[model samples]
Target: MTSNDIRFDCQHRGDGGPLVIVPRIDGTPLTELVDGFEIAAGMQPAGDAYGGLIPEFFRFGPMQDHFLGRSTNTMGPKTPVLGCECGEWGCWPLMARITATADFVTWDAFEQPHRKARDYVAFGPFQFDRHQYDDALQALSAEIGSNVDDTRA
Candidate 1:
């Protein structure tokens, strides 16, 4: 199914196991997303466990730069390390999922929880263009295919 067909504003929730993408509309089965949705690390989906996934939201890439430059209302003044790929759980976008609700809260830097907290729960609204995500997915698929071909050669 196309991105438009899927309800984009659903929340990602998990009960200590695999995440379930629930639609805002009641009575909808979360399983609907089985084939329709793809979990993205940022703007791109993660590769298989056998191969390490690449971070696509870095400020270095042209598209990522454009995406990072376009700040959403939720995100306040750009932090010094907004888009750094420091290998730490640095920037948000832990896992990007579209929601059907537009009324959701935006980004707030002050909300980042520390490990010392008794309980930590953090979720951010990922603001990204669907077309851009599709393009990035295609590019990643091509790159993986190219690698396979080189290995065979």
Candidate 2:
């Protein structure tokens, strides 16, 4: 009985709800994620259950691209963290270099690049030149897209 998606990002760029959502920028490397269980004696319990389907994430372990359990798993030695942000503040730091994939948006409410464009349009007319924003947004989006694809792959 999971709830909704909650996301994590080391390079957090905005504040408040409806963030410029993307994929995870970083997370513990697979080796470290697995080792954390060993170090903590499995006290944390892998897998987020507040809501959504992402079960676990690792940089070096089997859960590399996206996260650990995209849908569900056989229930192994998993662990859960307090999430990258809790309340108005971040409960913990978002680990770097691991992007997560999920059934839907498990954490933050997000959309793809085209969705972002729609949101931009909805924000109303741009007093400034659209060219500048267009170029800038495209460049940044490309950078993020590359990283996101790598993480998912």
lDDT of 2 by residue, 76-102 (tens): 322222223232112332222112333
RMSD of candidate 2 to the true fold?
17.6
User: In model 1, what is the error at residue 79, expressed in angstroms?
Assistant: 28
Instruction: Name the runs in model 1 displaced over 4 angstroms.
Output: 1-123
Q: In model 1, what is the error at residue 76, expressed in angstroms?
A: 33
Query: Listing every candidate in turn, what is its Cα RMSD in Å to the true structure after a full C-alpha superposition?
Result: 18.3, 17.6
Worst 10 residues of 2 by lDDT: 118-127
The lDDT of each candidate is 0.27, 0.28
Clashing pairs in 1: 8-98, 8-99, 8-100, 9-99, 9-100, 10-99, 10-100
- Prediction 1 global C-alpha lDDT: 0.27
